[model samples]
Structure formats: structure tokens, C-alpha cells
Target: MRSEFCNALVGRSGNENVLFMTGDLGYMALEPLQEALGERFINAGVAEQNMISVAAALSRQGFEVWAYSIAPFCYARPFEQIRNDIAFNDLPVKLVGNGGGYAYGVMGPSHHAIEDYGVLLTLPNMRVYAPVFNEDISAVVNCLSSELRPSYLRLGRGEAPDGYVIPQYAAWRQLTYGDGIVIIAVGPLASTYIGAFEKLPKTQRPNLWAVAQMPISANPLPSELLSQISSAPALCVAEEHVKRGGFASELALYLAEGGKMPKQFRHHYALAHTYGTYGSQQFLRSLSALDEGTLLSTIAEFAPTSV
Candidate 1:
């Protein structure tokens, strides 16, 4: 996802008003951007808060500013500056957060960003984007480039299955259709669901969808998603982040408000128990029941009973 995002940044090299600033990170990965962008690329040392303040000021001065860092450093570290300087003023500052969720596994809770989107969304005029596949990065970058509000792009590794052609990126994408259950995977966790889908037989698969944008907007909800949820016997939301104020909570609230709640809704997310433990991302996901194996077992429960 980092490489894809850098490529996207390089693609925007012609835009003189655009700037990419990082907090002393991106050692090897950002050289292309630095070379392409020339003086427009900035390394703000280890000062995440100061980097954000400067970026916000640059945006206020009509520059398209994108501040980059690890997930926690990008948003959590300098949250007040983001809220007051960017969101309060409604500045068009793009924040690129690499290693979202537990991607920086074994680094402990301080590095994990399970609540990044939830916190950022609470601010005024802030948009959260978590692209589900590598192919979605370019489209997401394009969206952020033109977005008028302070926005955060949570980066995670995602790849589509071989021979499966992903459609052009959108806020909501129906990856597959089935009758028994509606499976909604947010961000790179969609890859886990996709792996589970491939392992299951056609009769056991669920209606699968991937969501990229956050702060659920149900104003004329996507008819396809609405129909899938309206008819499926069960609905499940899979995300790497915590349940509260994340994708699952927002989706549930919006569905209930619209009177389109499913009969059985389950949320699989990063559990608090794992906050005290450290391991690889896959290991952490297994503990949180967000891995492919756990999903396969969970989906089986929602399968149609034999006649």
C-alpha cells in the first residue's frame, strides 16, 4: 500500500501546488517522490505535531498539503493541531497514515492505530478513507487530491485474488452476491474475507462487499447494499479497528436510523484483549477473530440449514 501510494504521489508530480511532507519516516520508499517532487517534498524530522501545523498552514495558504507518517504519529500524536488548524478551518490537508491497524505488529499499542478513523471523524469537516485493495489507492489519492475537507488516508496492504478484476474504486463495492448472509469487510480486511470466500463452496459463500469511505452517509444509500442487507438473513461487519465509533458502529447506527436493520448482525473487530499482547498482524487478527479461519467458521453459522 505504501509503494502504491508513493506511485500515486509521483503521478501527481506535475501539480506545483501539491506538497508531500513526512515526519522523518519513509527512508527508502520516498526517494522517488522526493526526486519527482523536488523541493515540494519535505522531511519534517521527528516532529509530527510541528509537521501537521506546518502542513495546515500550507493548506491555508492555498497549497495542497499531504502530511505522511505512521498511523498514530499522523493523527493521534498531533490531534489537537489537526482539529483546530485543519478541521476547524476546513482546510484541504490530506493526511497519509501508513501501517494502519496492527500493521506494525509487535510494536505494541503505541504504534497501532485501531481507533484512527473513529477519532478523526469526530472532528468537523474531516473525511476518513481506508482503501480496500492496491488498485483502490490511485482512486483514493485522486479523491483526496480534490477533497475540500481535512482528510485521512489509512494505508494497509491489500491485493485482489488472481484473475478477479476489481471495478473502479467507489465508496461501496459489492465484491460478490449470495443469498444467506451479507458480509461487509472494511479496508484491507476485505482481503481476508476474499480469501475466505475463495475457500468456501458457492452454496456456503455470503454476499460480500467492501467499504472504503467512513462516517456513514445513508442519504439515498446505495440501492444494491440496501437490497443485500434488506434480504439477507444475517449481516456481518469485518474490520481491523475496534468496534466503537468505527465502521461497524457507524453502519449499524445508519441502518437502524433508516429502518433497514438486519435480523442477525455480528461485528468482528480487533479486541481489547490483544491490546496487551504483541505478535504479527496475522497472529493478532486470529486473536481478535478477524482472520480468514475465524471468518470461515463464523460464516458457516449463517449458512442455510440442510433441508
Candidate 2:
């Protein structure tokens, strides 16, 4: 996603109105953007709140300002600042949260950002984006660039499977066709099942899809997307965030309010507790309920032996 962001900045080289700020967290991913955008790229130095405040001020002066940092600090440190300076004032400052979910494994719970989507989505007029496929990064960045609104971009480290790819940035991507049960995976978790799910026979497979863009912005899952797999016996959601206010919760409200609730519903997410242990992302996921094994096992309980 940072690669796409850098490319987009370079794509607008002469646009002096564009400005980038960081809270001392953009290591190698943002250096290219920094070099390409010289004075326009400023390091605010370990101050996420001040960084957001300054970006809000800059945007008020007709500059397109973007503040970038780790997911936890970007939101946690500057919660009030963002709510007031940016979203409250209706500024166009774009806040990008890198290393979303457990991306900063070994950095401990303080670094892992498991609650970003829920918090940001609840903010009035704050647009939240989570891109499942690396290829969709540029599209999300460019889409926000054209609009003048408060936006939060949640990004992963871009780890995808070897071959399967997607083009075009739809709010969601359908991964399979099934009539029994539908499994909805959010963020990078979509890639986890892409490999293992293929190993299942044609008849055993369930309809799989990736929902990245926040429903607050996308409004609702596309009518066609819902029509496709929603008829399944049950609707299961797998997310890297907590189960309460995250994607699954919002989806349930959407379904209930819209009278589109599926036959049955189930959700799996990160545990609602601090992840004390630090290790590889895979190891961390295992500790949480979002591990591939746990996710599949959870779904298996509701499906037949074919799954």
C-alpha cells in the first residue's frame, strides 16, 4: 500500500498543494515518497497528535495534507485531535494507519492495532478504508485524493498468495460460489483461506468473499454481492478485529436493518483481550481466535463433513 501511495504522490509531482507528514514511523516504505516529495514530506517526530493537528492546519490553507503512522498510535494518541481538528472541522486531512492488525508482531500489544476500524468508523464523516488485495491500494488512495473529507486508511504489509490477483477496487471481492454457507473474510485474512480453501473439493467449498471498505462509506454490501452467497444456510464472518464493534457487528446491524439477514449468522474475531505474547503474525493469529485452523474449525461446526 505504501508503494501505491508513493506512486500516487509521484503521479502528482508538480502539485505543490500535496503535503505528507509522518510521526517518525515511515521507515523504508515512505522514503521514496519523501525523496520524491522533498520539503513537502515532513517528519513530525514521534508526535502523532501534533502531526494530525498540523495536517489539519495545512489542509485549512488549501493544501492536501496526509498524516501517516502506525495504526495504534495514529488513532489512540490523537483520538481527540482527530475528532476535533479534522473530522469535527470537516478538514480533508487523510490519516493513513500502516501495520494494521498484528502487523507489528513482536512489538507487543501497544503496536498491534486491532480496534482501528471500529473506532474510526464510529467517527462522524471519517471515511475508513481497508484494502484486502495489494493491487487495490492505489485505487483506494486515489479515490480518497479526489474527495475532500476526513479519511482513515487501514493498511496491511501486503502479503498475498503467489498467483491469484484482483483488479478494480470494489467494496468487496467474491472468492467462491456456494449455496450452503458463506464465509466473509476481512482484510488480509482473505488471503489465508485463499490457499487452503482451494484444497477442498468443489462441492465442499463455501462461497468466500473479502469485504475491506468500511460499510459506513460503501453504505451496504452491493445488492449483487448479497444476492450471490447470502442465500447460504449460514453467514460466517472472519475478522482480525474484536467481535463487538468491528466489521461483523456493523454487518449484523446492516443485515437486520435492511431485512436481509441470512438464515444463520456466526462471527470469529480477535479475542477481546491484550495479546501479551509477541511473535510472528502467524503465531499471534494462532493465539487469537483468527488463526486459519480456528477459523476453519469454527465454520466446520456449522457445515457438513464436506467442509
Candidate 3:
């Protein structure tokens, strides 16, 4: 994703207002950007809070700025600075969080960024995005080019594409048509669910949606996506993060508060607590029962409530 960001930066070389800041990470993926942009790219030496302040100040100067760092440091370490300097002031600072959603599986809970979405979603006028496909990077960078307010771009590790065209919005990218069920996958989980779903016979498969961006407003509701989801008889949310305050929790809360809760709902997410074990991304997912085998089992046992 950092590579894509740099490529987009080069594409916008004529725009002198663009600048990039890093928190002493992305040594491998960021060097290309540095070579291309020269002094426009900055390395802030692991001081995340200071980086956020600097980015906000730069934005005040009528520059379009983006701060880059690991998931934990990018948003969590400098949270207070971000809330005040960026969101409160309504600056056009863009924050890029790499290695989100267990992308750093071996780094333990301290490196995990399960709560990033929930935390940033609460801030006023903050837009949150996560790409499921390589093509999705264009929309993300275009966001940098055109966003009028503060925005956060959540990214996974490596460069795996979703193997499908990324739609501009989640609801509009209906992967299938059916009233039986709606399975929505956000971030890298899209590939996992897509691969697992192939094992099921056509008779039991449900409708599918690849949710690329979080439609969070002051109301904190996904009302637009829900309008599309309402057509299904049941709904399921899949995410690499824990259920608490993640996509599923957010969706459920929105529906309940608005008095439009879906009667038949199911969600596949990480456990509320991790064992603190370390391994590759896929291994960690398996330990928490977010694997393809688990999905198959759940599908076989699914009752599909009548509500």
C-alpha cells in the first residue's frame, strides 16, 4: 500500500503541496517513495505523537499531508494529538496506518491494531478506509487528492490483491444476488472468505459484499450500506479484528439504536481475547478460529433464522 501511495505521489508531482512523513518504520517499502519525492518524504524517527503534531501544522499551511507508521503507532500512540490537532481543527491531514488487523501477527498484542476503527470512528469528521484490492489504492490516494477533511487509511501487509475489481462503495459491490443471506467481508478477510466459500455448494451460498470503506458520519451509522443489506434474509459480518466495537458491533449498534435491527444476524471475527501467541498471519487467524475450516463448519450448521 505504501508503494501505491508513493506511485500516486509521483503521479501528482506537479502538486507541490503534497508531503509525506514516516515514524521511523517502513524501511523496506518506503525507500522508493523517498527516492522519488526527495525532501518531500520525511522520517520522524519513531516519535509518533510529534509526527501527528507536525502533520497537522503542515496542513494548516495549506499543504496536503499524510503521516505513515505501523498500525499501533500511527493512530494509537498519537491519539490525543490527532483528536485535537487534526479532527477538532478540521485539518486536511491524512493518516496512513500500515500493518493493520493482525498484519504484524508475530509482534503480539502491543503491535495489534484491532481497536483502531472504533477509536478513530468516534472522532468528528474523520473518514476511515481499508482496501480489499490493489485497485482500491487508487480510490484511497484519490481520497488524499480530494478529501476536504481528516481521513485515515487502514492497510494490510504485503501486496495481495482481492482478485476482483474494487467498487467505490461496499453496498454497490454486491458479489452475488440472493435473499438467503448477506456475507460482508472487510479488509484482507475478503480473500479468506472468498476462498472458503468456494467449498460450499451453490445451494447454500449466501449473498456477498466486499466492504472497502467505513461509512461513518456524525450519526456513526452505515445507513446507506444497510439499505442494500436489508434485501437479504440474514446478514453476517467478517473482520480480522475482534467483535467488540469492530464492524459487526458497529453495525448492530447502529441498527438497534435506529430501531431497524436485523432479526437473523451472524458474524465471524477474532475472539474477544487473544492467547498472545505468535506466528504468521494465517496461523494466528487459525488459532482464533477465523480460518476457512471454521467458516465451512459454520455454514454447514447455519440454521438461517426466519426473522
Candidate 4:
């Protein structure tokens, strides 16, 4: 997905007003963009706050600016600048964060962005985008390009099942429709569910959906998704991010407010912080029970009938 984002940025480099600025990161993955963007590409050293401020300034001058860095650096490190200079002013500055969730596994919590979008979403004018598949990058880039507000693009791992046609990108789009449990996956974690779901028989498989955008109020949840939630016998929401301010939390609020809770509801997400351990993303996900095996088990448990 990082490579896809670089390619998308390079593809958009023809626009002189569009610029990409990184915080001395993106060593190999960003060569294409650097070459295509030329002087328009600025490596702002390791100063994330300054990078965001510069991007905001460029945006104020009518340029479409993107501040690039790893997920934590992009949002957590320069949060003050992001909130004041970009989001508060409603500048059209795009914050491109790579390695969302624990994608930078083994690098430890410093690189993890489990709380990134949740924190950014607090800004009233900020829009958060979490593309569920690599193929969604171009559409997401184009969508951000069309908007003139602060936005965050969280790049993570995702891919569609072979030969499966993903519908046009939307805030909420159904991947597979079935009875019983309605499974909702947020961001790149959608891939985890996509692969694990094949284990279940078609009769017991749940309806699958992915959420690509945030601040759900902006785009509004599709009526189809709402109807699925209402009718399904069980509901499960999974995400790499923590529960608070994430899809599950927001959706729960929506359901509770509307008095439409399902019979059985479960949320699989990054659990309590790992204070003394470090490993690969999959390793940590297993600890949180967010891995494929756990997902399959959960689905079987949630399914109306045995597989």
C-alpha cells in the first residue's frame, strides 16, 4: 500500500501545485515520487511538526500539499500543528501516514499508529481515510484531491481476493453478503477477515463489509449497511486500531442511539497496550486475538449454525 501511495503521488505530480513532503522517511518506496515531483518533493528532515506547518502554509497559498511520514510521526508527533495550522484553519493539506496500526511491528509502540485516526478525528474539520485494499489507493487519492479540507490517509496492508471485483470505493461497502452474523472490518484489517472467512461454509458465512473513510457523518453510512446490521442475528467489528473512537465504538454509538443493537455483538481490536513485549504485527495481533485463526473461531461461534 505504501508503494501504491507513492505511485499515486507520482501519477499526480504533473500538477505543479501538488507537492509531497516527507519527514526524512520513505527511503526506497518513495523514489518514484521524488524523481517525478523533482523540486516539488521536499524532505523536511525529521521534524514532523515543522513538516506539517510547511504543508499547511503551502496549502494556504493555494497549493495541494501532502505531509508524509510514518503513522505515528504524521499524526501523534505533529498533532499540535495538525490541529492548529491545518485542521483548525480547514486547510486542504493531506497527511499521508504509512504503516498504520502495528504495521511497523518489532519497531515497537513508538511506530504503531493504533490511536492515530482516533486522535485526528477529534478535529472537527479533519477527514480520516483508511483504504481497505491496495486497489483503493487511486480512488482515495482522487477523492482527497477533490476535497478542500484537512485529511489523513492511513496506508496499511490490504488486497482483494483473487478475481473478486471490489465495488467503487465508498465509506461503507459490502464485500460479501450472507445471512447470520454481519462482519465489519475497518481499514486494512479487512484483509484478515477476507482470508479467514473462506473457511466457513457459504450457508454460515456472515455478510462482510469494509469501512474506508472516517467521521462517518461526513459521508453517512449507506442504508444497505444499516439494514444489514439491523437484520443480522449477530454483529462483529474488527480493526487494527483500539476500540475507542474507532469504527466499532462509533457504530455502537449509532446503534445504541437508534435502539438497534443486535442479539450478539463482538469487537476484535488491538487490546490493552503492550508495555513490555514486541514482535511482528501478526504476533501482536494474535495476542489481541485479532488473527485469522481467532477470527475464524469467532465466526464459527457467532454463526447461526455449525459450519
Write down the lDDT of every candidate, Cα atoms only: 0.87, 0.78, 0.73, 0.85
Order of candidate numbers by lDDT, starting with the best: 1, 4, 2, 3
lDDT of 4 by residue, 66-166 (tens): 89999999999899999899988999899999999989989988899898888899897889999988989988999999887899999998877776777
For model 1, the superposed segments whose C-alpha errors exceed 4 Å read 218-220, 273-276
The candidate that wins on TM-score is 1
TM-score of 1: 0.96
Residues 251-296, candidate 3: write the lDDT tens digits. Answer: 7877787777765788887764367567877887787677767766
Number of the predicted model whose lDDT against the real structure is largest: 1
The TM-score of candidate 3 is: 0.87
Better of 3 and 4 by TM-score: 4
Q: Give lDDT for model 1.
A: 0.87
Backbone clash count, each prediction separately = 0, 1, 0, 0
> What's the alpha carbon RMSD for model 4?
1.7
RMSD vs true structure, all candidates: 1.5, 2.1, 3.3, 1.7
